[model samples]
Target: MNWQSIKEQLITFLKDEVKKTGLTKVTVGLSGGLDSAVVSVLCKEAFGENLKCVLLPSQYSSDGSIEHAKEVCEKFDISYEIVEIAPLVNAYLPNMEHNKLRIGNFSARMRMSVLYDISARDSSLVVGTSNKSELLLGYGTIFGDIACAINPIGELYKSDEFDFARFLEIPESILNKKPSADLWEGQSDEEELGYSYKELDDALKLLVDEKRTKEDLVKFGFNSELIELIDYRIKSNAFKGKLPTIAKIQWS
Candidate 1:
């Protein structure tokens, strides 16, 4: 996929985007996943010491995930801070039912809140970590992980992240690990999507990039149900990518 070329382009994109914002620094949420690992390296290369990595872990976050997040920061020599969010989450969850899905979504929003606050404190932008696969499948919390001032990796699919992350010299421990949001205990991305990223990304490319129809997908030996499933996700979750709607009013 010519990852080296894309790497250079993304770095340049990061620099240019931040420059346009008159901000020299950016804060990224490192989730100990392939996407964040790759984005952190890119931000580090682009902004150097100006890059800040915030580790927002809750009780559901695994020991390995925390260690992996710290590993990336240490390996890259990037500046970072760990913010434990158990208290904040616990403070609110006591009033609601203890549903993992709800808790996970709430955790994601809380993480985003902290990231934005850090960015405000440092006068930096929030660089998002969601890849194309997740974005397309609507696999993220609105106004949460999807929120960012600029994203260098948004267009890169999850399927390509492993190879791209490896090219970026991401830790093998991170690259080899299964993809999870660490939102709740034992929450897996693929499991939630009901399909592996490769399966999803491949179909997404055909469905989104190639503009192929369901009939064509079926002709290519792709199951109609999988195509339909992907289609529904794209249609349903499409709202996550947009800004809030504002009604027009003439006051003059």
Candidate 2:
């Protein structure tokens, strides 16, 4: 995919966007996942010492995730801070039943809140790590992982992200680990979605990028059920990708 060329373009994009915003620094939530790791590397290249990587680990975050995130910061020589969000999350949902989805969404939002606050404190813009696959499928929490000042990887699909991460020399541990939001123990992105990223990305390329119809997908050897499910997710979660709707009032 000409990753070197793409990498140069992305680094340039980050720098130009930050300049346009009149911001001198960039902040990112380093999740130790491929997506965030790639963004961190790009931000490091673009901002150099001006990049601030923050680790907002919740109670559910695994030790391995935190360690991996720190490894990226150390490897890149980027400045970072770890802000534990467990206290805040626990205070908010002390007695609630343990719901994986609910807790995960809340954790995402809390982490973002920490990032935005850090951005303000550091006078830096928040860089997003969400890839095109998640955005298209509405697989992220609204006002959470989806929130950012600028997204360098939002247009790259998950599979493309993996390639880019490797090209950027992200730690093999991060690149090889199962993709997760780390919202809970034993949580995996593919397991939750019921499809591997490679499978989903292939279908998405046909369905969204190539604008293929369901019949065309089936003709291309895609299962009807999978196509239907993906199409439904895209349609249903469309709201997450858009600004809030406002009612138009007629003047008297």
Cα lDDT computed for each candidate against the true fold: 0.90, 0.92
lDDT (Cα, tens digit) per residue for candidate 1, span 1-252: 898899899999999999999989999999898889899999999989999999999999988888999999999998989999999899999865998888888999999999999999999999999999988888899988888888888888898888888888999999888899998878888888788999888888888899988888999988778899998988998889988889999999
lDDT of 2 by residue, 182-247 (tens): 999879999999999999999999999899899999998998888998999999999998999999
Measured with C-alpha atoms, the lDDT of residue 53 in candidate 2 is: 93
Q: Which parts of model 2 have CA positions greater than 4 angstroms off? A: none
For model 1, the stretches where C-alpha displacement exceeds 4 angstroms are 250-252
Which predicted model would earn the best lDDT? 2
Clashes (backbone N, CA, C under 3 Å), per candidate, total 0, 0
Question: What is the lDDT, from 0 to 100, of the residue 52 in candidate 1?
Answer: 92
RMSD (Cα, Å) of model 1:
1.2
**lDDT assessment of candidate 1:** 0.90
How close is every model to the real structure, measured as TM-score?
Answer: 0.97, 0.98
The ten-residue window of minimal lDDT in model 2 covers 92-101
